[model samples]
Target: MTSMIRMFSLAVTAMLFGLCFAAPASAQATRTWISGVGDDVNPCSRTAPCKTWAGAISKTAAGGEIDCLDPGGFGSVTITKSITLDCAEGIGGAAGGILNSGVPGVTINDPNGGTTPTIKVTLRNLTIDGAGVTQGTYGVRFLSGKSLTLQNVSIMNQGTGSVPAVSFEPSAASVGATLHMTDVDIVNVQNQGVYITPVSGVAVSAFLNRVTITQAAIGFKVEAGGTATLIDSNLSNNGRALWTASGAATANLEGVTIAGSLEAAVFATNGTTIRLSNVGLYNNAFGIKTTGTGIVQSFGNNRLGPDAGSIGLPTATVTQK
Candidate 1:
């Protein structure tokens, strides 16, 4: 009947070109899985999983990986590219897999004249809980990434007022950004527990290992041309534990433990530079406070004070061990 109606119009034009080439090859899934009974239109599959890390980061694959197959709360995620949000194994530990009350439980905005100019983010074993319930100003708000890695993470009670539970301020096109925190724990953050500001002329760097900054008003706030390297860290009961400000800020504290700081366990101001090794300044009212032309370089196996107050500047230098 006219050659079977032109072979059913050439099989409906090859089934509409195989459904437009299989819908972008199934939306480019390099790896994507998120389950707490997932269903973000079911394609984020490790058996169709997807129940938020903003729906498995829109079916992940730009440098993909979003694996968390058991515990839930996986909300609040605004990472633009280069991803890896691994909840290492024990899926539901911190009150059943949470990223509570969120506004920023992870926001790494990457996209400025793209061709993947930067953007590298990796967060593992996550337990970001702001259940003290203002629910987020930041528990990782690195506003434009080049690199940010946090392992065994636990950023607690995120701040609302002065906002900082890991906020590496980067946006002058994400200026020289880099931060790597291992075995991290930033607790009760109501102001500043790791806020490395880098946007004036780009120079941000941070490397903290075995970190812990508790009860923060300010524990590690390295501003202005920043640089920080704290190992085996613990800055406790903070009003201000380590605050290096303005001029070319640099803080390299090793084996640190600054306790009960009702202000200043090392507060280097304007012309900042603080380098203390094997540090432990307990019950701090001021174990090391250097003013406007600040500099505290003590590399002694440091353990200062019963009733601490050591103000230095005879061109501050101490090398006792």
Candidate 2:
């Protein structure tokens, strides 16, 4: 009888141990791998990495992660899902950085199949060099998305083909997207530094955090109902530094510097609401121009720079050709 009791006690102890000490079998997010020399058709495992950004982007699940086996050799990736490309070590190292300059850089492919793609990518600690190739336009184009967040990524030397440096072309209102750019430096765009063209959905907001846009046709063009927020940015050496057509844009400027424009520094029209906070403007022409009932409210720490022009009070609101 004592032996039987011992056996029962052992079985009970084993069950209790399994319940208290055993780890729950939880699944982890899957990761895909990419390399400068990889196969797009192969499995995206660490041993056999994928070839193109388009391939990895299409394969990666929304909540999954993708890591580059070595420094990535980019060839214009189109995103269609939610994935994180951990580019912490930088793309090409000291000799040369990742090239998105010629042909197509990062194209947003939506018309592929199924529903339109809404890609959420987090690119951290990577230098995306455009190599002064402006033919095919844009270093990074966020065409259609639910929302885009670019953190600590540098997009330089875009627009060889008279295309804007960065183009945010949304699909429709049902798929209205927002672009949140953090610490992005856009330089040497021929036509425009940042261009937003609406297809069906005209509502778009572009937020810039510590961004510098220089040597372009226009610094920022807010077309239709497009809105932009500039924070700690430098806009210099452009035709109409900031042009707002359709008077449908709303701009919030904070700690921004605008310099070197042939015409008005900030050309606003169509009842646009332009709010300035600690802003600085130094244009050879008029400081600010407002037409069609648009208003530039000089609020809180906003000051016209040393080379900035006067408002001309009541008469100078409208720009003269």
Error of 2 at 40 (Å): 3.5
lDDT (C-alpha) at residue 73 in model 1? 72
Clashing residue pairs in all predictions, respectively, total 0, 6
Error of 1 at 3 (Å): 2.4
**Displacement of the residue 250 alpha carbon in candidate 2, Å:** 1.1
Taking all chains together, each candidate's TM-score versus the true structure is: 0.42, 0.76
Q: Please name the candidate that would achieve the greatest TM-score relative to the true structure.
A: 2
Every model's Cα RMSD, please?
12.9, 8.1
Give me the displacement of residue 165 in model 1, in angstroms: 5.9
| Model 2 pairs whose backbones collide | 101-130, 134-159, 134-160, 134-161, 135-160, 135-161
lDDT of each: 0.79, 0.68
Q: What is the overall TM-score of model 1 with all chains considered together?
A: 0.42
Candidate 2 ranges with C-alpha deviation above 4 Å: 1-29, 89-98, 111-118, 132-136, 174-176, 309-321
